[model samples]
Target: MDFEYLLQLILNGLFVGSFYGLVALGYSMVYGIIKLLNFAHGDIYMLGAFSGYTLLTIGAGVIGGQASIAVLVVIMLIAMVLTGTVGLILERVAYRPLRGAPRLSVLITAVGASFALEYGIAVSFGPNPRVYPVRLGNEAFTIFGARLTYAQLAMMLIAVALMIGLDQAVRRTRSGRAMRAISQDPKACLLMGINVDSVITRTFFIGSALAGAAGVMSGAYYGKIDFLMGFIIGLKAFTAAVIGGIGNLRGAVLGAIVLGLLESFGTAWLGSEWRDVFAFGFLILFLTVRPTGLLGERVTERV
Candidate 1:
């Protein structure tokens, strides 16, 4: 009911939603291309955060503890490359061989892969939450009684820019064309001389890269990273993908924004404990009412 508070929540929702969109894009892309859920996608995000954390920690000694803008950018880029490579390998090792297997089998494999990544990191990192060496200090500016941090603005800008870049790539690039073609009919694409496998592999890489970027930004923003942190967020991202229309790039972003706003307002109304309930409730409602989502068409769709 308070207008200023409502505006603040909106800004927060958009910021949160942008990151969700990043992760959800990975889900939607893999699903759209190979029809694999790639539940392990979230774990790749976890790894991204860890990768950045590790790099930053190594640089901490050199940078004297506080990471500058240049250092953070370099670390984020490195983490994205690492995470993208991991996604590429994951597709080859875990999902590619089972490409023709039953949907249930692939689904099970995805879940298994998810578990493997989650606990593997736990084992390696000892399961304790790692404090990110990179920190965006709490400098902020208020707008009409709503406080917005410069860090938040910078992060949101980067996320949105990445999302826009992806949308453009999907729309205007040769690889994007290949991806869409493969998505529609891989068999036909194979017949038409398109390398389906390559396209799908690249999809995973790009999606995972975006997710990795999100993970780094999130770690920097929130100031903590952990192995299992990706699990719930992964589920939420999937919900966003489904809500946005799995194969539709813009839809995924839109869905995430919707989910973020819903959670922001729902938490405002109900409480933090009820946040997940409200978020997932939208998933169920959308599934029952409009399975294809706001932008998904009944006709064959492309990623």
Candidate 2:
């Protein structure tokens, strides 16, 4: 391929990968703390997009014309808060009660929760896709012969900012320390006077909030929202988290970028039809060859 074509592919990969990373962060965080896959997590992203669409639709009636950046930011924050609450409720209702039950039970509950969210939205919103009220304009600028859009740039920057903020929160704060402690040994943390339940709830909140933010950005960029939109993205995010070492935060981001690039290049070589196949194939290969993931440390299980 030519330099410009290659550059465009790279940019596309980065743009899509940023959102994947955001969604993957939620997967990694929840699994790290509770060891639950939380299959419904992607629906939380779908809900977020819907939530942002609702808020913006209301705002459009009041403000009229194109929305200002401040208004869009406000809508995004509202969506994050709304989705985060939904995630908290999901954990409390679906997962927490089964904490001491068999892992298989919890896993099944996760699938059930996913179905509930998907069909619930379908029933409430109808099966038709809704157009996002505000579409971020695809005003393009050329960078080294590769076309770049303002919307894509904005989404990428926002995703990066959120990822960095999450990384800092997990590494720098007292809550971060509590989270780490609980992940290492929940019972020991409780014995040490740490509020394990509260920390876990906070983790869900943060992770879901990130997913929500990604949802809104995606809606704006893509200009359409549907109940089923999260299914593929969710699976892709899970693959990313697994590739990065399921419980590793930074690894999720790295794996997402790598996966995105792979998809971009794969689509260029094969067709778009093979994108999912390519991504899943990599997941299987990674599982077989380096299950610990690129950044994950290998651990020996004790009998």
Candidate 3:
């Protein structure tokens, strides 16, 4: 491939990786606190995208229309809040009661939840895909011979900002300390007067909010949203979290970029149909070589 094509692939990888990373955060956070896969996370992501679309429709007073940046911002924020709230509710209703249940039961419940969410969305929004209006004008500029779009840039910026903020929150804020306490030892956190349940809920809020933001960005960038938009992306994001070291925040981001770049180059070479094959192949290879992941810490479970 030419240098320009390589650059373009790299840019594409970064843009796509950002979205993967955002979704992965939800998986990682849930895993860290609860050790449950929350298989319905993908469905939660789908809900976020649809929520964003709905918000845009209402905000513009039309199905889709050009809106000012401020208006779009409000719509996006509302969508995120609504989606995040839904996530909290999902955890409480679907997962919370099964907290200490068998892993298989939780997994099954997650699968059921996923199907219910997807179908519910379909029934409400119709089975057809909907186009998202370009709140940000569609414009492309070449950087170092690589074509880059404003939507892609905005997606990257939002993803990076959220990632950085999440990192800082975990490392610095009081809530972060509470979260870390819960992740490390929920029983101890409770003994120490920390609200373990509240921390977990907040974690869900942040993670789902990130996913919601990603939904808005994805819809805007791809110019489309559908009931199943989150399935493939959610699965890939799980791969990213596993590859980067599940429960490790930074590892999730790193894994996402690596996976995205690999998929981008793979699509360029092998064809788009083989992208998932390449990603899963990479995941298997990585697991075989380093099951703990690049940045994942070794932990011993006490029986």
The residue-by-residue lDDT of candidate 3 on 1-303, one tens digit each, is 789999999998988899999999999889888888878787777887788777776656553476555565566677789878988998999988997788889989988988898899999989999988555676899998999876677668878988999999999999988887777788888889987888888888888888888887777767788988888888899889988898899999998998899999999999999999999998888778887777888744534
**TM-score of candidate 3 to 2 decimals:** 0.94
Model 2 over residues 193-263: C-alpha lDDT tens digits? 99888899999999999999999988887889999999999999999988898889999999999999999
**Which 10 consecutive residues of model 2 have the lowest summed lDDT?**
294-303
lDDT of 1 by residue, 1-303 (tens): 888999999998998999899999999988888877888888888989999988888878887666766677788899999999999998899899998888889999999999998899999888899999868878899999999998888888888988999999999999999888877888989998888888888999999998999899989989999998888889899999889888888899999999999999999999999999999999999899999998987645333
Report the candidate with higher lDDT, 1 versus 3.
Answer: 1
Best-to-worst ranking by lDDT: 2, 1, 3
**Can you tell me which runs of candidate 2 are displaced by over 4 Å?**
299-303
Q: What is the C-alpha lDDT of each candidate?
A: 0.89, 0.90, 0.84
Q: Report RMSD for candidate 1.
A: 1.8
Kindly indicate the candidate among 2 and 3 with the higher lDDT. 2
RMSD, one per candidate, in order = 1.8, 1.3, 1.8
Residue 188's lDDT in candidate 3: 86
